[model samples]
Target: MARITAGIATSHIPALGAAIDLGKTGEDYWRPAFAGYEWTKQWIGQNPPDVVILVYNDHASAFDMNLIPTFALGCAENFQPADEGWGPRPVPVVEGHPDLAWHLAQSLILDEFDMTIINRMDVDHGLTVPLSLMFGQPQAWPCRVIPLAVNVVTYPPPSGNRCWALGEAIARAVAGFPDDLNVQVWGTGGMSHQLQGPRAGLINREWDNRFLDQLIGESDALRHIPHIEYLRETGSEGIEMVMWLIMRGALGRTTRCLHRHYHVPASNTAVGHIVLEPVS
Candidate 1:
């Protein structure tokens, strides 16, 4: 049976990509930000997976208000980095595992998830930054990526419980696949910081840390946190944290944390990362 080897959650801040593209990783402002990912890079180097099921939201770069599917899965053979008003980052195009992606689409639909099947889509910093942080600037990404874009940008995004349920369904599809492949589901974005409007630069270090602790130790309790609480305490953008529950649910009820890091002020966002392996 195919297996889920690991789960990862991190913030997909666009500035992190700029830091990489401009070679400012060691600069004063970005030094601490980049430091948070150092352990993740080394861990991935040692324990690589065959494919990554990346869960992130598009920032009006790929999907505008006109077309926002609550859940969209990329089945393309490759996805180019989107030019989000600025020129596209100098990142390698992401390769897709079509055969597995197709199987997943079929499985998810039958399982009542109703995911929109995307044949072509441009992935934004939300997808690529995480790749850059975890794998560095490789000419070609080290493994295949299956992009799972969730609609957190919209007002009525999927609820936290709903996202968690989808991840649980995905776990079944992944395990039932006949091929022997190592799969890692990554839920990227958030750790309590908001951008835009009067509340532009809000950072809740205490809330963010408490979230990380609960995410690892008391995830079941974390789910009870309503969307309004995330908006009220974490800022509107901080609501993206619900995506992490998808990764957690995919790992089953028990997991072992392999590596974890949290840092602040990455372009007005608090960055958080955690690596987990199912307690096999």
Candidate 2:
């Protein structure tokens, strides 16, 4: 049966993707931030998974305020990059694992999680940026991807506890599959930075680092964090960190943080990334 071998959490800042696409990563302003991921790229190249279940939010690209699904799963054979205002970030089309995605759709629904099954949808920076951060600028992504879009853009998003439960369910579903494939669950977004309003340039490094520490060691208490606390401490957009619970919850009872990277001032956002795997 397929198994979730590891979990990854990261912040998907759009400017990071732009720096990569525009050949500006070598510049001094972006060099330090890019340097942090060099090890991860090498690590992933040596240990590639058959498929990656990427959890991220849509930035008014695929789903607008008119139609927002609390949890949307991509079941199509492939997904196109979305054009967010300027244009799509010259990235390869995302290939989907329909067999596994469909199975997850069925399993998750039966497990009482209402998921909007999507046959086709364009993916935005929220999804592609994370891929770029890990895999670099390849002609095509190394492995198939299943897009699990969560609604953190709008108010009343899923609670941390609920996201954690969904991750647990996904692990159970992957284990039930008969194929002997290695899978990775990735939660992308967060580390505290806010845009808009009076606190437009907020970056609470202390709180962000503390959150990361708790995530690595005290996730049970982390999941209970209220949304208002995120807004108050990390900024409004910092609420995206809640998605990390999904990745953490899927990693079974015990896990060790193999790698952790944290950087600041990347497009006014904190870049946080961590790699975790089951202890046994």
Candidate 3:
């Protein structure tokens, strides 16, 4: 059986890429910010899991406001980088793990978790930004990816509990795979900040840190946190933290913390990162 060895959570602030590519990571304001991800870069190089199940939300990129599925799994052969208003990033398209993705989708559906399985889709900065930061544009990505996109755009999205349940389902699916492989699941986005009309640069470090601590040791508590409260306190878009609960729930109760980093003011959003290794 394959083992899920590591889990990670990071903010998908697209500006970070712009900052780095423009050679601003060393700027007075951004130097300390980019310094935080150094540990993550080193960890990935050392562990280098075979497959990375990237859990993130689409920012009105692939799925517009028309129709949104709470949880969508990508089982495609390839995914192109999206052209969000400005332009597409200079990077190769992401390749998918169809076999593993299909198996996981089948197992999850069998386990009573309804999923929107996608055969084709273009990935936006929500997914690519993190990949660019974690692993620069190599000739190819270091490992195969199973992109699980959650819908945090439309109103009345899945509850935190629902997201956590999906995580549990994912863990079961990964464990049931027959081949011996190492997998890492990542939940991207959020740590208290909003992007919208007037209330743009909101940051609640207290809530963000507490959310992180709970996710590591007591995620069950997070399932009960109401969405309205997350929006009220962390900001409307910050509700994306619910997605992290999915990654945490997938890891279950036994996980070893490897590295945790947090920063604020990344262009009106708080940036956070965490890495978890399953304890055998």
Candidate 4:
């Protein structure tokens, strides 16, 4: 059976993707941001997964107010990079694990998660930036991807606990798959940032670091943290961190963290990344 191998958490700032595609990594503003992901690329290069279940939110690109699903799972054979009002980034099209993805979607629904299954959609930076961060400039991504879009942009997004529970469901779903596969679940977005109105550019490195500390072990504390607090302290956009809980919960009761990288001022956001695996 396929086994859960890793869970990754990260911040997916749009500017990070733009910087990568425009060859601006060397620029003063971008050097530090890109620097943090260097070890991530090397880490993944040394230990790559056959499939990655990516958890992220679409930034008003694919599903707008007209249609919003609290949780959506990609079951398509492929996904194209989105042009978020600035043209698509020069990245390889994402290949999906339709077989596993369909199983997961069905299982999640059966488990009472009610996930919306998607067969076709263009992936936004929320889904693609993490790919660029860990895979670097690859002609084609090294493995198949499953895009799980959360409704963080819409008001009243899923609660942190709900996200964590969904992760648990995914864990159960993946563990039951009847295939020999290595799968990784990734949670993207957040590290204390507000990108709108007068509060734009707000960042609380203290809270972010503190949050990271608790995330590894005392995640229950992190889960109970109110959404308003995430909005007030981390910034409205920072509430996206709830998505990280999904990644954490998917890694099972115990995990051995392999790598963690955090940096600030990535175009009005803080960048954080970590890799861990379920420990027997």
Task: Score candidate 3 by lDDT.
Answer: 0.85
Measured against the true structure, the TM-scores of the candidates, in listed sequence, are 0.98, 0.98, 0.96, 0.97
Write one digit per residue (lDDT tens) for candidate 3, span 167-209.
8889999999999989888899887888886787889999899
lDDT by residue (183-251, candidate 1, tens digit) is: 999999897877789999999998888877866643577666889999999998888988998898898
Q: Candidate 4 on 131-199: residue-level lDDT in tens? A: 998998899999999999999887989998898888889999998999999899999999898878999
- The number of residue pairs in model 3 that clash at the backbone is 0
Q: Write the per-residue lDDT of candidate 2 for residues 27-71, one digit (tens) a residue.
A: 999998888888888888988999999999999999988999999
Q: Between which residue pairs do clashes occur in model 4?
A: none
Off by over 4 Å in 2: none
Q: Give the candidate order by descending lDDT.
A: 2, 1, 4, 3
Give the higher-lDDT candidate: 1 or 4.
Answer: 1
Q: Is candidate 1 or candidate 3 better by lDDT?
A: 1
In candidate 4, which residue ranges exceed 4 Å CA deviation? none
Judge candidate 2 at residue 126 and give its lDDT: 93
Ranking of all predicted structures according to TM-score, beginning with the best and ending with the worst: 2, 1, 4, 3
How displaced is residue 181 in candidate 1, in Å?
Answer: 0.6
Candidate 4: residue 41 Cα off by (Å): 1.0
Question: Which candidate should be chosen as best, given lDDT against the real structure?
Answer: 2
